[model samples]
Target: MISMRHVVFMNVAEELSFSKASQLLFISQPAISKHIQLLEEQYQTKLFERKGLHIELTTAGKLLYERLQAVKEIEHKTEFDISVLHDAIQAKGNLKLGASTTVALYILPKVLSTFHSQYQQIDISVLNRNSESVKEALLAKQINLGIIEENSKVNQIQYTPFITDKVIAVCSSKSKLLKKKNYSIQDLPHLPIALREVGSGTLAVLKRALAKHKINFAQLNVKVRLGGTEALKNFLLESDSLGFLPKISIAKELKAGELKEVFIDGLALQRQFFFIERKGETSDLNKGFIKMAKSIYNL
Candidate 1:
């Protein structure tokens, strides 16, 4: 097992604050300070220099931080490998999961249900949030694993393709644009548009697609920006404005004629969902869950 002091030091090194590290490690500030003090005393090296209210890692601290990352990676991998073998011998335990809005709503439920039925003893907890928030939760160690749209370029996270889905323009049947099967990007300026909030995976995907077409997102003429899929769906159902959403999200509504999907000529908006985790190694539960999910999803 890794030393508690080393773990605390790495957390503090990553966060650069005693308070944030404490919150992350579920320890108090004084406890965090004591652990850091112990590590520094044992090594006889200063780890951090105080800069105003901020703490900056010294050269020796940076070296130890890098070494700790490698050590933790090895430790995690060994433990996971053992767990994998143990699970193969007897599969039992709990799995904690996190997913972006689209995956939670349209993709994971059925898969999770099937996994539960097969492995009746394996408990599952799924935390739902937007992609960016899900990533943050994973980074904070609040979740063991996460599925999200590919929006991050952070080197510390690993992204593996989970599945592909499309985002389409949807509106109430009462929308003036309902009569058209295809509309140009230029025509979107005339319609009242509903959009997802900033930092949302859906919004990020949409922005990237629009940028490829040389369209400025600021010129989209949005009527409102909603916080979640449910909110955006409700607003679209009650208004004539159009909104972009994952196809899987409104499958039932579209079939029921409550919403209509619109397309743009020469513009294809497809986003790939990815399984993400902190870069380095994965545990047995993490590997198992991802493999099982992909098999179930036919990915």
Candidate 2:
């Protein structure tokens, strides 16, 4: 169990305003201040720094926040386990899930539907964000599990390979770029490209692959940066710009003749989707879901 001061500090750290923390906790502003003061005195370090009307966590505070977040997750999991063991409630429990855009949009719908049908008692909530943001949410305990495609590894999180996905360069069927007998990877920089915005897992993979070929992202003529995969696909259908998307996502369009895959002689863009959770932390619910997903996807 965490102390009252620790809870107060977390609230203030998240909100970045003592008054907002007080309102969130339903405590007096002076009481919130006193609790933080006591914590600071005990630690013999300043936890926050004031910048005009805003407040930000100091180095020490940031460290404490990270540890405390883990503690909170453990506590939450403990309570959930106990409830599942004892309570005769109608609803089994809630599963908080976070996923990157690709997984959320292209992958999870059918899996989620099947899971819901099989386990109607379990309530599910999903938060969708970029891969980096999904990882951050998992670490902050805002989500119990995450599915992402980022290649960069974080020590605090453990990644289990979920599924293999490929990112391929694609264009509208009407694009003139298809007139060439063969497209070479070297020709990519001169073509008009539409890419996912920064922080996207697809974009990350594209950059790493390009770097291996001695190509910089700035060398590509990026005409637009879209935030969602669906939006990027729509943009491709309207314009002649080339874009990279998950093969699974564009299957329908490719079959319908609205889009065509642009093959570069030497370029093969592939990435793996991962089941992410905090290192050394696992719950029965998360384990069951991961198992079900693997079975459903035949992975």
Candidate 3:
């Protein structure tokens, strides 16, 4: 077991701010200092030094932090092994998951709700970001596992196909663009449009689809770019602008006559979501959640 003092020191080292570490640990700043002091005394080496108003990890701190990361991997492996010795539903531990906006807002909740009903002792937290951010978070060790719409093919990470998805161009049901039964991809430059921001997997897939016909993404008459799916979806509802969104995101809106899907000749935007983790990792918590998600969605 790791010492509380060491935990405090590691948190402070990771954050480089006592105040931030205190807030993260729900302890006072002075108590954070006391723990760090104890840890430094135990090692007889200063773990941190002030580089300004902010603190920076000293060489000793860096070494200790790297070592602690190794220890953490071992600890999690031990916990995972021990937990599997019993029935999985009876196990107790924390799970951290990162997912892109579509999965977090739509796909994940159903799985989480059902998983929690069976394993009430397990604590769960989710980080919602775009697919690229989710990938970066998993690589940074900020999340134990990630569900992403983009598979970057990085060698250090393993990807398992979760589900297939498609992005369709859509606009408000009342928009004038609907006057035409079907629009060609060539007409996109004339249509006012909203778009998801760069680094978004939705945008990435759309870009690839556009490139198939030798079209450049920059040629579109994009009026605005939003950072999230809901933002772009809402923007389309209020303004009669065209935008591409995941089919899963706007299903209800499409059914309710609030939005209408626009067909583009020869432009197909489709992608597959993947469950990603560190290479060679076989944590039971990660497997259990993946299995649960697949089962919940009947995939």
Candidate 4:
């Protein structure tokens, strides 16, 4: 087991802010400093250094953070294995899940509902972020499992195909863009479009699909960039620009005639969602939660 001082240090190292760590661990800033001071005294070296307005990890701090991450992973795995060894159904533990905007908003709600119904004893927490941020959170050991729309084979992580999603171009049903009878990829550069912010899976997938036809993202007239899927969807509702969004997100809007999906010739915007994790993570709780998520989608 890791020491309390080390736990405090780890939180500080991850957050890179003493006050932030204090807030997260529900301790006062001075107490947080005391723990770090004790750790530095024990180690005979400085773990962090102050630079003007902020702090950064020293070389020794980096080493300790990396080793402690491994220790924490092992500790979590062992505890879960022992706790759930006799009865998984009644096991009490925590599952931290990280998902991108689309998965968090659309895919995981039903999955979470069903999982909670069976494993009521287990507690679950979810962090919603863009695809890239989700991957960073996994690397930081902030979450045990993640579901993202990006299919990139990032190193040190494993991806399991979860569900298939499609990105469809859309505009408000009453917009002038809908006045056109037919659309093609060639017309995209001339159209004003709203895109998701950088690091979003939807934006990444859209760029790749557009690239196949010798079209670059800069060529399109992007009117606005929104951070979340729902934000972009809602923005498109009030704007005249075209936007690409996950089919699942706008299904209700499409059916209600609030938004109209524009079909472009030879452009297929299909994408695969994946359940991702650290390559060697072996928590049964993680596996069981993933199993439940996949089962709900029948994939």
Give me the candidate number with maximum lDDT.
2
lDDT of 1 at 192: 85
User: Mind giving the per-residue lDDT tens digits that candidate 1 earns over 120-155?
Assistant: 655578899988888888876666679999875678
Ten residues in a row with the worst lDDT in model 3? 72-81
Candidate 2 residue-wise lDDT, 53-141, digit = tens: 78999999999998998888677666657766775343366688999998998899988987787667677999999999999999878
Models ranked on TM-score: 3, 4, 2, 1
Any runs in candidate 4 off by more than 4 Å, and if so which?
15-34, 52-54
Q: Count the clashes in each prediction.
A: 0, 0, 0, 0
List TM-score per model, in order: 0.72, 0.79, 0.94, 0.90
Q: Mind giving the per-residue lDDT tens digits that candidate 3 earns over 1-299?
A: 77798788789878889999999999999999999888889899999998778888889999998788767766775775687677666677778899999999978889999999998877799999998888888887778899999736889899989999889999999898899989898888899999998889999998888888888888999999999999999999999899999999999999999999998998888999999998986587889889989987788
Off by over 4 Å in 1: 1-90
Worst 10 residues of 2 by lDDT: 84-93
RMSD of each: 4.5, 3.7, 1.7, 2.2
Better of 2 and 4 by TM-score: 4
Give candidate 1's total backbone clashes.
0
> Best to worst by lDDT, what's the order?
2, 4, 3, 1
Better of 1 and 4 by TM-score: 4
Give the per-residue lDDT digits (tens) of candidate 4, residues 1-299: 99999999999998899999999999999999999999999999999999998999999999999999888877767766776787776777778899999999999999999888887878789999999999999988889899998747788998888889889999998789988867899999999999999999999888898898999889999888999999999999999999999999999999999999887888889888988999988478888888888777786
